[model samples]
Target: MSRLYGDPIEVWTRDGEPSQFVWRDRLYLVRRVLDHWVVAREWWKVREGDPGERQFWRVEASPGREAGSYELRFDTASGGWLLMRAWD
Candidate 1:
């Protein structure tokens, strides 16, 4: 995965699933959610007060005719989101 590393974004959700997201001044509509999972923080490796669990979604998205697979993570503690990776 390509680490985007804290790029802020806007997401739209319906029924608690991501329907679309805005990143880099463009909107990508989610076509399908391929997978979902949660990653709990590693207490031994992570410091206290760091963001807790992360909810991840592997999705297929399209901005008009261009399409790709993307991995997105949501920080449960802070309610912040990241675009972790994109495959062209």
Candidate 2:
């Protein structure tokens, strides 16, 4: 798994699910959504003014070639997205 810490991205969602994303100037289309879940921040661990409630989608995506699995995250607090991790 390759970690992409807080890398901002642009996502296209369909029916509230992430269908594709633009990252690092490339577009990756999601082929399959393997899993989905939500992670609520622990109040004790959260600092003041920090974002919380991350929604994660584990999916198989392709950039016009062989598909790869990746974990994409949506920060509910900030309404932003991130490419969290990838399995090549």
Candidate 3:
């Protein structure tokens, strides 16, 4: 399990459009929202998926400007972004 110690964020997105979210000290540009679904099992995955899980908002981002629909995942361990999914 990963330790989640930081400010949570609220995300706002639209269909087929980029997303926008803000954490505590920085703002994030959502590359894309991927494979959002509800998960009601495996408490372990709850770290990434939680109890009564309703969705997985996957995304991708960098330290600079972003474009198009891309996939980005936030690592709860390092507080960084990783590319998980994307569109061509």
Q: Pick the candidate with the highest TM-score.
A: 2
Report how far off residue 37 is in candidate 3 (Å).
Answer: 3.1
TM-score of each: 0.82, 0.84, 0.42
TM-score: model 3 vs. ground truth: 0.42
**Residue-by-residue lDDT tens digits, candidate 3, 1-88:** 2223334455555773337765455566765455554335456555653243334454554326644344434443344433344333
Task: Give model 1's TM-score versus the native structure.
Answer: 0.82
Residue clash pairs of candidate 2: none
lDDT of 2 by residue, 1-88 (tens): 5756668889999999999999889999999899999998888866577757899999999889899988899987788999888887
Taking the tens digit of each residue's C-alpha lDDT, what string does model 1 give over 1-88? 4445457778899899999999899999999999999998877755577757899998999888878888888987778888988876
Q: Tell me the deviation in Å of residue 45 in model 2.
A: 7.6
> Cα deviation in Å at residue 19, candidate 2?
0.4
Off by over 4 Å in 3: 1-6, 16-18, 41-52, 63-88
Worst 10 residues of 3 by lDDT: 1-10
